[model samples]
Target: MPFEHYKEVDLSSRNTLGLPSVSQYLGAFHSVSDLQHAFEFARNLSLPCFVMGGGSNILLPEYLPGLALLSSDRSIDIMGDEVTVGAGASWDNLVAETLKNGLFGLENLSSIPGTAGAAPIQNIGAYGVELARFVVSVEALDLQNGLAVTLTVDDCQFEYRDSLFKRHPERFVVTRLTLKLSTRFAPILAYQDLQRLPAQITESAEGLRRAIQSIRAKKLPDYRVFGNVGSFFKNPTLMKSVIQTLEQAQVLNSNTRSAQGKVSAAALIQAAELGDLSVGQAGISPKHHLVLENRGGATLTDVLTLAHLIQEKVERRFGVTLEIEPQQLTQLIHAPNPKG
Candidate 1:
């Protein structure tokens, strides 16, 4: 084996929500050689395998039930406006580094809590900026054959808030990310909140990042402080006519449009009057309705129940379904909850 493996590894602290989870087998791999060896080890045991990144966007099961792969490489290389980042490297830190290196374009994505691997996996976006815009190529391994592959940006098939990597999690494990950034500063202040920034702040990259970070600080609770996924439900994007009907019914407000044809998920959740609601120890975040928090010692069951209740209420009120944003480890997609 290219690297040693551990059994029954504790994963509570590995995830942002601090859920108590354990993996049947865990291996830290530095290169493709190590990844292949780990996969072979899992194959010998007839178990499944998955790439585990910063764990910020996943709801882990109590037990992972298979091989949990961890990327140990954390290198970041910069040449002019191009950068090559190890998958395990911090996404926020990468943004910061690029800004310090005199590169622009990632300022609006400041403070997103996840690793580089998770960025493309989620096609992370904030304040009108999506990670897909800067991605040139992604280096990954085809898990089935353990073959190294570099996928062009088009091969990624990035969408509103999704990517092929997310849809085909079982097929690939991201190893590195290559981005082509810009030397010129072209700030994207299209989002309403960003447009409110003082002209002086918009003139500099760090100032723009500070403004975005400040807005996030007010909207989301720090995961370290209160165990939670930043955004629990993705905004329901529909045809403008569909949302207009909901608006006529007094379900969503005209100001709630975050993007064209996308009504705010937080608005829908609030319309259900669920901001003050809680199920057991899991509660809808009072600060932002889209955030679900573990008040204290909350189980996955508690969170799911609370989320289901919100979904049902919103669906009944507006005839629109709310989709959970964080990936579910137990079931990738939500199945209908009969009781709801």
Candidate 2:
């Protein structure tokens, strides 16, 4: 099959942040064949390629020098409690559909942007659940030899906001994911916010989903209104000793613990007086300090500058380094159309 390829592509609106980017070559792959073909096309030219889905958790450079492959397949198959979803399927749609079918485990993850394929890469989580808990397996193409491989949950090596795929990004391109959900309702009320859920809405899947959705809507800035890529920094995790030091110094608030040894990044940033901070058109969201917004005409440089400023302030004030959550790309080869 001949793969469709385009050149000089404008991706200003592709990313949730609405940053302007131009690719020299862009390939839209709709099937396994198309995906492989596009990769081979880039390989032939010895150009670096970057695979993207839904354009959510990424920071792209102003110019991509090589191929930008987009996974656009959207297929979902359900069998009992097991679901096999295409990488390109809408993540929110998956959450909504699973609840509609009486599946339980995904309700807490509702309303996250990006495609199904991108979830496990960051071990995407929210409210009190992580995608790793439901992922049965992942199918990926080994870009090294153009072969396919399946990785079980244990092989994923999921840790706070990270996975093996994120660690070895150049080695594999994910194709699909299989998730094992539950037929019974079991809401996780461990999160402080969820613990406050009204009694009337705590028993059913739909109700829990709606409640989580409402909370996210109220707290997070709508990317449409003020462009952003959700949480801009990973919640900085500290060792027990380090946390104790910060606590003694009174740099963190009393209600900052998230897990046995972790604290909330937002709280630290807020404590450091980094909220509502700005650098050019990029500014920290006033509603949520962890979100960096594209106020308008924000450039990649502006975003990075603001991010650095935040990092410096948070670190100087709290002695903990703030790590960026989104993946950053200096450049990915997107070659020009040969026939053009």
- What's the true lDDT of residue 34 in model 2? 75
Which runs of model 2 end up more than 4 angstroms from their true locations? Answer: 248-250, 331-340
Across residues 1-340, which tens digit of lDDT does each residue of candidate 2 receive?
Answer: 6668998999878899999899788887766667778876876777678888877888988998888887787888899999999888999999988888888899999999999988888999998799999988999877666677899999999988999988878766788999999998988988888988888898888898899999999999999898899999988778888888878877665578755767888888887887778988999899898899999999999999999988998888777898999988553223322321
> Which residue pairs does candidate 2 place in steric collision?
25-334, 65-333, 65-334, 66-332, 66-333, 66-334, 67-333, 67-334
lDDT agreement of model 2 with the native: 0.85
Estimate, for each residue in 66-144, the C-alpha lDDT of model 1 and write its tens digit. 7788888889999889999998899999999999999999999999998988899889999989999999999988755
Candidate 1 — worst ten consecutive residues by lDDT sum?
Answer: 331-340
